[model samples]
Target: MENKIKILLLEDDDNDALLIENILTTSDLNVEIIRAKNKESYLELLDKLDFNIVISDYTVPHFEGIKALVELKKRNKNIPFIFCSGTINEEKAIQCLQLGAMDYVLKDKIEKLIPAVKRAIKLVTETLEKEKLEKELIQFKRAVENVHEVIFYTNPDGIILYANKAFEDIYGWKIEEVINKTTPRILKSGLYDKNFYSEFWNNIKSKDHFVIEMINRTKKGDLIEIKNMISSIYDANNKLIGFISIQSNISERKKKERELQRAKEAAEEMNKIKSYFLSNINHELRTPLISILGFSEELMNEITEPELKEYAKYIHEAGQRLNQTLNNILSLVELEKKRIEIKYESINLTELLKDLINQYSKEAEKKGLKFITKFESHKISIHSDYEITKKVLSIILDNSIKFTNEGGILLSVRTEKINSFTHPVINIVDTGIGIQSEKIEHIFEPFRQVSEGLTRTYEGLGIGLTIAKQLLDLIGVEIKIQSQLNKGTMITLIFPTVAKEEEIKSEVEKRKITIVEEPYEKKSTNPEILLVEDNPGNRMLFKKYLSEYFIVDEAIDGLEAIAKAELKSYDLILMDIHLGSGIDGVEAFKRIKSFPKYKNTPVIAITAYGMTDDREKFIDAGFTDYLKKPIMRTELIETIYKYTYKNN
Candidate 1:
């Protein structure tokens, strides 16, 4: 089998054309030869057919080898061309070669045609392959230049070597200007110090790749942030050659992050200011309220006329409602701040609910509403914060009594097994003005009220249910409400139960106790009490209420209280927290406790800042007990008797 070769021969002699074909045939190449004796035939062969090689005589009738070569060049074809002439000069041969001729073979040396033709064909094939590769390289360069991200190449010394068009577009710098220039330092915005760059370079050199966010300045001196991903380019022998980097602009993203941080900081500062203002406002309000409530109760107890006593009762009730409103505001603040802490203890749910029912039942009767209780189990126990749970129940029961005008309220309790646990669920059903279905979803939101007009009958700050829901959620309890407008509302509270443990004896003793009437007696020991307060009215009012039962000693501020405390040992010390123009009560208590005689002297914190965490704060400050301001006469006496009489 012979390899095929197509040839276009421009020669006037037919014998010479036949001789050229015979040489190629003997060289194991199948020759497909087309003869063109003149310019007309040569042009026709070139236009009509594809030939691998062209052979022409140096001198024909009018057309020659140079003309043929010039014609092939006009067509812009890459086919190999050679001249076969018997009378060609050396200069003419060099001229033909210079004009893109592959080779020239004399007619006398026609045997050399075979080798010369093979060389020319081999050279053309290599040239075509090289041209194809050059086209692909051009396409690849175009793609890199059109990309959006800034791309650059740098030497191992961090000197810039090459940059794409995107680099110029983004940084406003031509490639000629940046070549051989060191990066980062030229573009540094001075946002970072030398230590930052030192560490960054060390990391990249060790890791061989690095991505970072940095602030830089453009040629226009505008500050911009960029996220740069850099990778080290290495040779096949694992030697570091250079680095390539792709950078994306992130100035807008960084600006947004800074704005959000500023906003967060502003909000935090505002919250601090609000909390401080509320604390001061609470103290100012409670101080006057204590005087009003204390004096009113004293008048109610000692007044002889019926009408005057009723007036005193009204004043006390009004003060009580105002104090409750203040407390609700503080509680909502604490809940929002997430400062309400739950102290879990083993609780007797049955006893706690019964006590709450008894307390609210009298209020229900006063409002001409019947209060009923149903218990499916007598001994229901759960682990929860006893005080918080009691407050939650009181809030629900008070709302029921306040909203109900005609019908009654029913309280029910039961135990059911739910999801591998026995849960104690309490239900409060009221036949009051029920909530609308659409409004039920938002009922638990703070300060939300169903009736919102000046002439509205409901009297509340509308935070009872909000506080109840928050407190219930804190203790891992679930609540459900079902209501119908103008008919009734039922609320269910489900408490997670704990396994039976040893009953808390202290909790049993803390149950509601009725004050027993003392028989008239003349000879008795009078309990000594220390009243530490800054407000003169609060001191006078507290003395008037307490002086009837005990001998009271007064101190105007924490410094005076400390002086008096060291002088004598009292049965109990009532310390007001915010002592004006002197050391605070907490500091005075700490000083008094340093004395050997007053170490165990039971100091109770009587403070106006009665938020949810107030008691915990006092307890942590080494107080034996805590009480909120605008204190009732009964509660005050009971707290004293518990610490004094019970211990004795």
Candidate 2:
């Protein structure tokens, strides 16, 4: 059976409608007709039914084929429209055809109606398919134009064939201007040589894909960096057809990379300068500090009067505070360099916290603020570095006491679970002046402060929290801060529990040092010693501290020390690292060790270059031990006694 074709007849006469139906039926095709005698009936039938074709009698009494055609055109209907009229003239027929009638047929010659109907139906099917394809093409164009990257197609010879709208936006070129007239080389910035393009083309031709960064110039004479990916289009037979390239702009990323490299270099230079300045400043300050501390302690030891001894004790304490500040600066530098070593030990958190509280309680009381402590138990133990943990706890407590003026501070310790393991949590809560919300994030950055200017209230180098955070990080601890403006602040420290017994044993073993003693002693009344120092004040201070225990000889520089050591047999040498004009302490010690007599004698490094690497450097240069400046009298005396007496 033939497929049925639906037809709508807009004819006023019954005779013409019947004649058209008979003609279609006799043409060996299945046809169905729906008749509309007026404009109203025609529109109603058009809306109610789907028709493959419309055949209307032109120039009817009240309605005409042209009016029907106009209605169809207004509704955007694409059905085939034909004119079939009995009394229409040539001019009228031409007008009907021009008004979008697919074909014209006369009623007197109704035999021609079948052929015209068949032709119009065939044309309608092709027209529908073509319209669908055009719509799809428009959609594809829109998709390509809306993409962000530049896309273009070129022939095998590299001449441009098609360019998307994004290419116009990126390269500042009109699509019409570039087609068949430009090649990829037209956008080159000459940043790469011919060899680069040669290898790139060769690789893509063989591998069918090439991706790289390209520097190109726009039509407006601006340079841009782009990440370009080019793929070779191929046919089923593996023959190269053309090329498609997609380019994303990377100029901003490249610019940032260059800026970062420059910034890194500048930071490195600044660090070097800072290291030199700190070394010099510490040396200069510690020379006088040692004198102040040593003389005060000596005065306190010899004085009988209580008030005078009290005055001397205060002087010694003040000097110690200055020395602690210098040590903090040096420790921070070492921490930043990742050179600080952590010596782990099993520590009782209760005892450590209690001792720290007692130490700072007096300072808090002096400021009229009470210090409270809440320890969970008396036997809370954790594996950690004792000295570093102590320093970190002190930093947090100091900050709490320093900021809180009106309300008291509370210190608490307990055991808590963090992740998969149990950890010791220490919290310090202060009812003092709190940190601002915006400044909390920046508090752990070096030298950052909430208030600035000459009249600001707080006093600190702003390195306390930074040091605390870094030291805690070394021992696998976490710190968190919570604060509100004009209210209070709380800092929490979580220390990870050490699980292995081997670590604790190894730490203890590594810290053990054995001193050998001679069996028979040829003891001298006073052992001979050499004091090598560039600064006169430091030299005098060292001599005075050691004068009662040893026969001291002084050298102004490394060369003078070497000259004195060669002539005399000295028992010990205190060599300063930074000599003014000649060799430093390391070099002088190496020269002194060349002689067999002084090689066995102890030469200790006494300078302010006390970084992590400085000790190793001094030991490698033949020094027996290393000591930092602003030395305490007791420490100096003990070290001297150990070496001088043990050897004899």
* Residue pairs whose backbone atoms clash in candidate 1: none
What is the per-residue lDDT of model 1 for residues 187-236, given as tens digits with 9 covering 90 to 100?
A: 88888999998987876787565666788888888888898888889999
Off by over 4 Å in 1: 1-148, 164-166, 333-339, 370-382, 410-429, 436-445, 453-456, 469-473, 476-484, 487-648
Query: If candidate 2 were superposed on the true structure by all CA atoms, what would the RMSD be?
Result: 24.7
lDDT of 2 by residue, 434-473 (tens): 8899899999998876665687788767788888988876
Highest-lDDT candidate? 1
TM-score of 2: 0.58
Q: lDDT for each of the candidates?
A: 0.81, 0.79
Q: How accurate is candidate 2 locally (lDDT)?
A: 0.79
Residue 80 in candidate 2, Cα distance off native in Å: 3.6
